[model samples]
Target: MAGLDDITNKAKEFLDSGAVKDALSSEQAEGVSDKLLDGVADAAKKVSGGKFDEQIEGARDAADKKVGNE
Candidate 1:
C-alpha cells in the first residue's frame, strides 16, 4: 500500500511539475503509465494471494484509458 501510494505521489509530482509531458514522448508516457498500473496490479495480486485479479485488471484498464486521454 505504501509503495503504491509512493508511486502515485511520484506520478502526481511528474504531472504537477509538467515534467512527464516534457520528459516522455507520448508513447513513452503511455508505456510508463501502463507499467506503473501493471506493477500495482501485480503487487496487489501477490499480496492478496491472487484473489484480486479482477480488481487489478480493472485498474490496469483504467490506467490505460487515462494515458489515452493524456
Candidate 2:
C-alpha cells in the first residue's frame, strides 16, 4: 500500500507541477492534462477496489482546477 500511496502522490505532484502548462499551448495542455488525469482516475478507481471513489474524484477535480481543463 505504501507503494501505491507513493505512486498516487507522485502522480498528483506531476499533475500540479505546471510543467505541462509551461511546455504546451493552452488548448493542447488542457486536452493532454485532462486525458492524463482521467486515465489516472480510472486506474486509481480500479486499484482502490472502488473504495476511494471520492478521493479519486477529488484528485481529478483538483487537477482540473489546478491545470485547467477543456
Candidate 3:
C-alpha cells in the first residue's frame, strides 16, 4: 500500500503530465464547456429576471481570458 507522501507525489506527477491541459484545449472539450456555461448563464438570467446579464457576461469574459491564457 502507498503511504500518504507516496500518493501525494503520484498525484502531483499526474497533474504535471499535461494530459489535463491537452484535454481542455481540445475542440470537443471547448464545445462542451461552452454549452455548459451557456446553459448555466441562461438559467441565471431567467432566475434574475434578466438583471444578471452583465454579471453573466463578465463571468464568461473572465473564463475566456483564463482559457486563452492556458
Candidate 4:
C-alpha cells in the first residue's frame, strides 16, 4: 500500500510543476473535470476503494449551487 507521505509528496510534485494550474486554465479543464467526476462514480460502483466520483459530484454541485443553478 502507498504511504500517505509518499502520496502527498507525489501530489506536491504535480502542483509544484504548475501542471495543476495549467490544467485549471486550459479549455480542456471543463471536460477533464466532467470526466473526472464520471470516473469517480464508476469507481464507486465497484467494491470500496479510493474513488473521486463523490468528490467530483460534490465539486460540480457546489459550483452549480454557488452560481445559483438548480
lDDT of 1 by residue, 1-70 (tens): 9999999998888787755555553777777877788788888889989887988898778667767335
Off by over 4 Å in 4: 1-3, 35-70
lDDT (Cα atoms) of all candidates against the true structure: 0.76, 0.81, 0.76, 0.60
In terms of TM-score, which candidate is stronger, 2 or 4? 2
Candidate order by TM-score, decreasing, is: 3, 2, 1, 4
Clashes of 3: 0
Error of 3 at 61 (Å): 2.6
Question: What TM-scores do the predictions have?
Answer: 0.56, 0.61, 0.66, 0.38
Clashing pairs in 2: none
Report the error of model 4 at residue 64, Å: 7.2
Clashes of each: 0, 0, 0, 2
Best by TM-score: 3
Tens-place lDDT digits, model 3, residues 1-70 = 4698899998889867788767767777777777777788888889999988999978976775544222
**Candidate 4 lDDT tens digits, 7-62:** 99988898767666665656666566556655755566454454555675576566
- The best-first sequence of candidates by lDDT reads 2, 1, 3, 4
Model 2, CA-based lDDT? 0.81
Measured by lDDT, the strongest candidate is 2
- Candidate 1 local lDDT, residue 28: 74
Indicate the TM-score of model 3.
0.66
